[model samples]
Target chain A: MATADSTSPCTEYIHIAYPVSPIDRVTWVDLPDALWHEILRFSAVQDLVRMERVCKKFNIQLDRKDRSHGAQEQGREREREREREQEQLSSIHDLWKTHCQHRWNDKPRYKLTDEREDWLRRHYDEHFATVDYGDTAGGATGRATGRATGSRTESSHVMMGNAAPFPVANTASSSPSTTSTPSLSKFSWKKTYFWMEQELARTTLTYDELESLDWYFNFTPLAGGRGKDTLLRCIFRHGLLSIGGAGFPSLPYRMLFLHPGDNPDIFSEQQVNATDQHSDTDTTTDATTDTETHDNPIFHGGIDTSQARRHNQEQAVLIADFPLHYVSRLHDSGEWLMTNAHVTFVSTDEAGALTYKDRNFQ
Target chain B: MADEGNGIIRLRSSDGKVFELTESAAEISELLKDSPREEDDEVTEIDIVRVASPCLEKVVEFMKHYDEEKMKEIPTPLGGSTFNEVMDQPWYQDFVSDEKMNRDMLFNMLSAANFLGIKPLLDLTCLKVTFQITGKNAEEIRELLRLPELTPEEEAKAREEHSWIFEEA
Candidate 1:
């Protein structure tokens, strides 16, 4: 808090006449080039990219000779003479290869023979371009139907459907890029690092991101439904379903679901019919209106207009008022196990806190 | 002075303040280990002209508590968001936390650590700096470091050249 010109209050009585020397107060800019390099060594790749924008000093420090020194002929000549031997030993390709290995150490190493490809950028694009959230229908439909059903069985289906295609689709998309590269020479590892960070921020939901959403579903169980559902609330965004309620653990449990494809009609006919019988005409019309607004293709199949009308009416009514006639049968039926969804549980620790656990999901 | 025969080394700061430490503790700094010793009264005294009293005091305190076995290795590309999560020792976390160390003092401590060739302190200070720089944009980083604003032309050119970084995901 003390400024360079302000003398310490403790030192005022001892040295009232003499002011503190300005040379003693050092700023970040005053640090020597050697110390700057030491600090740069500790920075991550994304930090290095942003540091270039901080000031010209950092920009010049982080700039590569090939990219930044086009007009400086004299400096380039000197640099060439100084780095002739070093450049031969460690090429730009080797430098980026080391970066790729360090950042994605867990990824399987590939023996690449192509010299023209920018392996680091390719690796980033392949791994992060599309974050698999399971099949599309599984995410969107599961959310809509789960809100309507409000049963533990439906919640399990939502998890299973959302988790099914994530790991499999991710691996499927990433493998082909390693072999196919025609325009990778234009990319740089530093840019790729920024892109990866951006993609990560987009896919992963922070506590703040969750709290900002206006719509959330609280599915309290109807009579005869097992367990107390008073505290359970679910928020779905970017194909991620976050479950948090009162008395739940401090960690917010999140499930990632990817593709939003066909709606498989996971709802049982008997449950749909029973709920439809209890719904009044006004609520049925409102449910139809809600379905029309979403315009989702998943709900269009396997139901006649009357059955669909009744189902929509039941869906419009809150889950608390709906009948739980099919709860026992759905629990014993094991119907949620239809998909091969590999559900990975992602839990955020505390508010605005990001840990290695979230990064692993990326 | 009783520990003069026990290999106690005396370090003199630029502002005429002297701090004493055992030779084992002093060995944490390569500069201290390699400094030419004075044989006055069978005690060693080395002058460090670059480090002032306040920075040297911190350096000496860190060296006194230096333990090779207990020191945790700081991870590269920092895996955790906060320094407390990354650093296992609470004492080490408190050493560089904002409550105890200000920006100027932290930079000065870094300079002193660098000048004295203390690798662990250097790494710890740099890690603290890296934590500050992480997850912050360029303007925020400039504000944190108290750097002056760039000229209008330079700012536009820099942004134009690195437009990808400025774009939202």
Candidate 2:
């Protein structure tokens, strides 16, 4: 608990000046107004906000750029992020498509045949609806259901015994014979929801040995205050998990996944070769070892550049004694928040029994 | 009407002196634009001897160049443009040369930045002043700004409010 690494640099800034030089040193109107104008134009709005506070002069309380500015700035950013995610999904689709249809190609495509097109689109719509930034249905792009409606079809295929010929959606459009098999019509439309649920279910982090990561920050989930404060404090006694974009306009996104008690440090497990890595081969891990085995959810895909919006890695995340939600809102303006998507927080259900209050030094 | 930029506007300094300039020159004060339209008439200047007439002249010069997009070439607080070269403008040198004149002007400029709510200009100007005032003791601060030396009681009040900085002697 009392490690040298745990305690070191402490930087806190406080500003106070008396009547003679209320802001101390100099004032702005004194500077040629031209100099002031130039300074305002170049900086990002966020940085300007902070620079403003340093002195009464700089505190230009710019009304947050009007709606148009926010749309132009933040909206455009959202669009770019969406595009990047789509591109990655498309690549993943290609692999699934090729391997299922024509293993011949080096890479496969997730062929959105006519039959599954609508279903797939619906699925996409539904999936995104429930995820982070929720509920507002996007403009229905005609391409949604028109693509892979076939594979995700509501109809069933005839299965001959255990080989339960799954209605693979990636049937090649080029393979004409593969289409219209009467055999496909003979079966029952079994709702694939069970399998689908299994596929889409997200495993909560720290299900196992991941508990050691508690040192990262006070990850307890609690809403700090009901009023002005809107900050989710990430407390840590020692280890620093620098979480988001840096300096002033920083937005943190990268998540540090943890689980409850598999060997949180699996890399040290000598008997087993890397079990949680690329190979899907099963290993016999006892309950204790299982805890150790899946300790940390290593981004097997590595640091995703596509996900590094706002320079995600630059943020510093620490463990506070409580959950981030417990900290008062840093900007809780009655806006509905979606976990990880809108400022950080977890509802009481997600992070049981945490007490945090909203407090601000300012 | 199109000559709104060239329209006439009047600015009265804190000590009841009025100077009429084109609307554009007056707009340089941002306080007008940012203030509630209804309150515009109330901003009639009181005295700001801290901003000397010579400094006002320089401010006008700055506004003239600034209106023509000159400020855009200068860096701002947002995008990290440290165009320090702009500070080297000859007049900037002369403005600071007569410390007494610039000192008063600097205070005015700071007040103007505050009134206008323009962060960058305020930051740059204030930062310049900080360098001028940094490390200087209270007596020097009062003398440099021409404020009369504070009476013991007044000095104590000021210190009490801002005890964050302490004299170790």
Candidate 3:
């Protein structure tokens, strides 16, 4: 692509009898190094590395740049120079970071969270592990229990694995005393497994595909064994589904829950006029809706939960219920995600009475 | 704030050559614009004394083509790949081709553009130099820029250290 053709009469002014300088041996070397860097600034990552091999002068520039990243290692005298160089390197790193994050638009990108940072640190070392209870014990029992009484508990004898035991307030309908009950012990300690790669964001769950699923099951389990309150707590701990930028789906992806067909249950469904619109909901999910309505079985709660936080929306959907029976509010916010969950007690009796519990964990 | 009627700016180059350009064309050089000048001054003389005469003359010629009125019509390329492609167009081709301006001349213009704060000229010159050396191997670039060759051992070490970038090539 290098060509030098005289485009205009401007060449008339060109001095042919100019005295040649001894420094003409390296014409580029005569230019200020900063101008060279400005030229290199437009170079691609691969080209930048390639330029290091150009000559000792260019190589030294690249070497200084590489060293500038770890400025802490430099001696005291060059500290200020290293800091300035570090600033330039960081701006480039920011561009690389944005490229890797898959940012597509001018929309405000999500900030990195401590949880995601920890996850990324572990990921680079291949140490990041997430226990997926849904694939093994939870999956088998979830299928065995059928639809109406979808709830199942793990035996307390089962090893908890890496998942440390946290206190759970059992709010099972059998004991409405508002006090801790003995049945809370019946909930089995679910074994947590370090997730293999395929389960991490891609196929495990599409954060934006909630409307298509019977009820979107993210990292939180649908069937809570103990109390509804504890289930809400577990959901709060785990339900904050990951947004984009930190992990996978590196595009401007979001679930626009404001669509007409997707009636977001921001408040109790009871608060809204109960129209006979159940058929429309069933039509959306089709056959899966029947099974989900009858059973409420916890599907795949895709394993890893990133840091979460509740922002702006006072009534964001945490735990989404089908046909507007329940709603969850943003109870808690972690650095990376915000979670809301709605837990409803299904009445097996013909009375058809249902209890709705809304909880927040901020 | 010089009078608009038939005004001209005289610029003295580093090699002691005096070149005259219309004030409209001279305005493209930020160095000329920032200097204090009286409205009654007939021919405003600005010393672009740091740039070589030939490069200063070339800058004047480029400014003549893209005077303030014409520059408004050319779209600025979006960054990255698009910017590179824009530099390869016919207009830029005629301006940056090696046959018209050799390596030393372009380098001279680059320094001149920098000193004068003529942004488009600076960018065009930088793009020309970048395209010349960007994809070429070290030996090829050394031949192009006429730099002394590295010793065999240094070449091998550089090759080894930067093998990752060479992998794609």
Alpha-carbon error at A312 in model 2, in Å?
18
Which residue segments of model 3 deviate by more than 4 Å?
Answer: A1-26, A55-362, B4-6, B68-90, B145-161, B167-169
Instruction: Report the candidate with higher TM-score, 1 versus 3.
Output: 1
DockQ of 2: 0.05
Tens-place lDDT per residue, model 3, B82-152, is: 43465545655677686788777887778777767788787777776767776566556767767667678
lDDT of 3 by residue, A49-129 (tens): 455565665443345635556668768867977555555444444433433232212111112434333333323221212
Looking at candidate 1, what is the lDDT of residue A150?
A: 27
Best by DockQ: 1
Candidate 3 CAPRI assessment class: incorrect
The weakest ten consecutive residues by lDDT in model 1 chain A span A333-342
Model 2 Cα lDDT, one tens digit per residue, B38-81: 12242223222234444445455555555554333233222322
lDDT of 1 at A121: 38
Q: What's the C-alpha lDDT at position B119 in model 3? A: 80
Q: State which candidate, 2 or 3, has the greater DockQ.
A: 3
Tens digits of lDDT, candidate 2, A12-102: 2111111222223453333333454443333322222222223223211111122224444567676575454344334333322332232
- Candidate 1 runs further than 4 Å off: A1-23, A40-46, A61-99, A109-188, A191-362, B1-5, B36-42, B67-69, B77-79, B164-169
